[model samples]
Target chain A: MIEAEGIVHRYPGFSLSVSRLAVEPGEVLAVVGPSGAGKSTLLRLLGGLEAPQRGRVHRRGPAVYLDQTPYLLERSVLENAAFGLRLKGWPAQEARRRALGWLERVGLSGFADRPARALSGGERVRLALARALAVEPAALLLDEPTANLDPANVARIEALIRAERAAGRAVVLVTHNLFQARRLADRAVFLLEGRVVEAGPAPGFFQRPADPRTRAFLSGEMVW
Target chain B: MNEVLEITLRSLAVSSAATLIAAVFGLPLGLWLGARGAGRLARSLLYAGMGLPPVVVGLFFYFLFSRNGPLGGLGLLYTLPAVAVAESVLAFPLIAGFTMAGAASRAEGVRRLVKSLGGTETQAFLTLLAESRRVVVAALAAGFGAVISEVGAVTIVGGDIRHATRVLTTAVVLETRKGELERAAVLGLLLLGVTLVVSGLLVVFGEREAA
Candidate 1:
């Protein structure tokens, strides 16, 4: 489980405050908001990529974070996927074997030896997914994972997210897609102007938002 | 003719030695500054260092090693070692500056991803270096070019001693002054050739990186 309490992060002209946020095992928590509502910032804080000014972030197991545009190492695809295992002190051969397996899972086995920089946008996203899943992290924080992806890639990614959820990993997804939230999220939190305007089970939140801003956001109206 | 060969070899040896020393110190310094994101102050200092004149560096070391100067008892003045010291001073900043730029480029993304993947500080740094290796090669080529073609610094500190401290650049000056135009031309061509080889390597690396 990963949880944040009373988190307050400030920037030059903006601030994000989250009184409480939690992700339990096997739960898919979709964070939705308009652009600039601090979705990425919130993911960074949860992933330990950034620290909040005043808050306690607690996580019970290892976690991995993936940004919208995955940053692949400038090396062979297999090496990039095996990077986390190497960092964890796994033997090189064993790590490569497991990375190849993950690559196969993501349908990238043919490009194992190819340079990561040569990968196309969609392939790079899949490579990043393989890299993240090879380590089998207990928690995964994905920021705009399917944003700008083609529908085919989007469906593939959503299926992978469901598989991770089924395997009992906590998944926090940040997206602007209401349909995606309805399809994959067990719970949904609507963020408005850096504040959580509403949080509840995905169906109720999408069908009957308690907050006016959430209703407005869901109704195809920009809340900002 | 044999003297030209000797001078060319000595110049190569001296400059190569200087490049090795500069890389030893400069690479780590650059990496440190780069990993820290190289604030404006650091960038300014490095650029200023890059602009330092080779003659001034040579003169600085000349003062340090001259008999009447401090630590003169070491008797390093007018020697190959003294010339190398000046060359290293001239080359260090070029290597370090380029290295800093290369390592810092696209670093934030890699840093964040590495951290999230459980990489230790050292591992993360090594990853950054690996990612920036091509640029580092470019830095080395630039440093090598700066040191190898330098005449002012080696001339001032090396004293152009025949069969001992004489290098290609200083030899060219000597030949030109003594009306040995043919010899000077030869030496000059050799110098240009060396620069071209290094530059060619730089171009190839640049192309590879771009691809």
Candidate 2:
């Protein structure tokens, strides 16, 4: 479970304030917003990458945050995948074994020995996902995990997220793709200018947005 | 010829020792400064240290090890270790500053990734340092280059004592003073050759690691 209450984070000219938010086990909560709407900030807060100035984040078990442009270690792909496991004090052979299993699951078995920098864009994301999932976190916070991926890569990643949800991990997905939210989100929040404009079941939130701003954004009328 | 060989060996030993010592201290300092995003004042101080005059460092050590000086009781004023220590002081800033620049460039992303992967603070720092290994190697090379070719600090501290504290740069100076221009030129070339070989090895190692 992941929960946040009264999250108040501030920068020089911007602030993100959320009174309450929660994601239960086996749930996918999509945070949909335009650019600069604090989606990534909120995700970082929930993932404990950054502490909110005035709020509490309650996360059960471990939570991993995947950045939009994932940072891979300057090492072999196998080592990159095994990084988290190694950090948890797993023996080298055991970590590599578990990492290899994840690599096969992500369809990257053949590229295990290659340097991580040698991987292409989509392949890097898959490797990042493999690294994250290998740790078996209770919550996964993804920030634009598939921003510029091809359709096939998108499908593969979406399938992985679905599998994680089915396996009872809470997922907080921050995305610009409304279609993707509609496809995978059980509950959704529409954020505009750092405030949640509407929150409900994904279907109703997309189909019958409660606010005119939400309708405007949905219709592409709300320009940044 | 035997004297030349001995001088060359001694020079390599002293400079290598100094470079290693500088790296042992400098690399960690650089990594910490880089990880913390060193401020303008810290950067300015580092740059100044890198450009510090070698003779100034030599004088500082000379005074410290001189009789009636603070460490005078040790009687290390004209020893090989004194030369190495002086060279280390001269090389330290170069290694640390280059490492700081390299680590600063890549530390943030690596640190964030490590932290997000449930790593502790120490783990994140170690990961950052590991990721910047290439930079550290290059920094060591720079330190070695600076110390191997340095003459002023070794001369002041080691007193260039023949068959004892004499090294390539100091020997070059001694031969030139005796008007043995050919011998001085040969020693100079040997020093250059040593620097070139060490630097070449480091570059090849870096490239191999990249591959």
Best by DockQ: 2
Model 2 chain B: weakest 10-residue lDDT segment is B202-211
TM-score of 1: 0.94
Model 1 lDDT per residue over B140-189, tens place: 88888889888888988989898889888888898999999998999999
Candidate 1, A74: how far from true, in Å?
A: 1.3
Runs with alpha carbons beyond 4 Å of true place in candidate 2? B200-211
Per-residue lDDT value at A59 in model 1: 82
lDDT (10s digit) by residue, model 2, range A1-224? 99999889999888899999999899999999899999999999999989899989999999999999999988999999999999999999999999999999898989999999889888999999999999999999999888999999999999999999999999999998889999999999987777888898888899999899999998889988
DockQ of model 1, rounded to 2 decimals: 0.55
- Which regions of candidate 1 deviate over 4 angstroms? B196-211
Q: Which digits, one per residue and each the tens of the lDDT, describe model 2 over residues B9-90? A: 9999999999988988999999999999999998999999999899999999999999979999999999988888889988
Model 2's alpha-carbon lDDT is 0.91
Candidate 1 chain A TM is 0.97
What lDDT does the true structure give each of the candidates? 0.87, 0.91
